[model samples]
Target: MNTKDMRDLDDAELADHIKTVRRDLFGLRFQHATGELENTAGLKTGKRDLARALTIAHERGIDTNK
Candidate 1:
């Protein structure tokens, strides 16, 4: 998703998206470690998406710890 999409989400939605993406990132890491992941670049993409969600959350003053 892009900045415009991120900005469209409310705080609660952003938080949920962050959580879901983080879970996907974890799964991707596990798959990569086990040599089951074909697309290794998924890790990088996951990290970037997570970071983007987090940056937007923080900048919007949304509590990420939730």
Candidate 2:
């Protein structure tokens, strides 16, 4: 998802998106460690996406730690 699409999400939805992205990033790391991941670049992309979401959440003053 792009920044524009992420900005369109409400607070709750954005939090959920952050969680999902984090989970996906974790899974990618696991796959890479197991040597089963073909597209290793996904790790980089996932990190950037997570960072974007977190940045947006921070800007909105949303506490995503919950």
Candidate 3:
């Protein structure tokens, strides 16, 4: 997801989107550990995306529940 897209989201949507990205990252990590993941670059991408979401959440002062 691009920052432009994230910019369009309301605070609630931003929080939800962060949660979704984090979930995807968790799954990706699991797949990587099992040696079942293709596109290893996705792990990096997922981390970056999760970071983007987190930055947005922080900037918006959204209460991210850990």
Candidate 4:
């Protein structure tokens, strides 16, 4: 996902997307370990997406310290 796409999601939606992305990341890791993942580049994309979402969330000032 791009920054513009990430910005369109509300906090709740972003949070949910983060969870889903994390689950996907876990699966990707398993596939990589088993040499079943055909696209290794996807791992980096997922990580970047997760970081983008978190950065957008933080910029929204949602009191992450809590």
Candidate 5:
């Protein structure tokens, strides 16, 4: 998802998306460990997307530290 799309999500939705992305990241890591990952670049993209979502959430004062 792009920044604009990420920005459109409300705090609760953003949190849900974060959880989903983390699950995906874990699966990706497992695939990589098993040497089944076909696209290594996807791992980087997922991480960056998660970071972007978290950054946007922080900028909106979501108080993620709670």
Candidate 6:
């Protein structure tokens, strides 16, 4: 998702999105480590997506550690 789309989400939605993104990113990392990932670029994309969400969360003062 882009920054504008992410910013449109409310607190609860943003938190949920963050959790989902983290899980997906973790899965990508695991796949890469196991040599089962065909698309390595996904790792970079996932990290960037996560960072964007985290940045937005920080701006909104949303606790995503949950």
Top-TM-score structure, candidate number: 6
Candidate 6 lDDT over 1-66, as tens digits, reads: 999999999999999999999999999999999999999999999999999999999999988888
User: If both were scored by lDDT, which would come out higher, candidate 1 or candidate 4?
Assistant: 1
Q: Summarize candidate 5's per-residue lDDT along 1-66 as a digit string, tens digits.
A: 999998988899988888888889999999999999999999999999889988998888885543
Write the candidate numbers in order of decreasing lDDT: 2, 6, 1, 3, 5, 4
- Is candidate 1 or 6 superior in TM-score? 6
Query: Residue by residue across 1-66, what tens digits does model 2's lDDT show?
Result: 999999999999999999999999999999999999999999999999999999999999999898
TM-score versus the correct structure, for each prediction: 0.94, 0.96, 0.92, 0.85, 0.88, 0.97
Across residues 1-66, which tens digit of lDDT does each residue of candidate 3 receive?
999899899988898898898899999999999999998999999999888888888888888885
Better of 4 and 5 by lDDT: 5
lDDT of 5 at 44: 100
Q: Which ten residues in a row have the lowest lDDT in candidate 6?
A: 57-66
Candidate 4, residues 1-66: lDDT per residue as tens digits? 899988998888888888888889999999999999999999999999888887887888754332
lDDT tens per residue, model 1, 1-66 = 887899899999999999999889999999988989999988998899889999999999998886
Highest-lDDT candidate: 2
Query: Model 2 residue 38 lDDT?
Result: 100
Provide the lDDT at 48 for model 4.
Answer: 93
Error of 6 at 6 (Å): 0.4
Give the better candidate number (3 or 5) by TM-score. Answer: 3
lDDT value for model 1:
0.92
Clashing pairs in 1: none
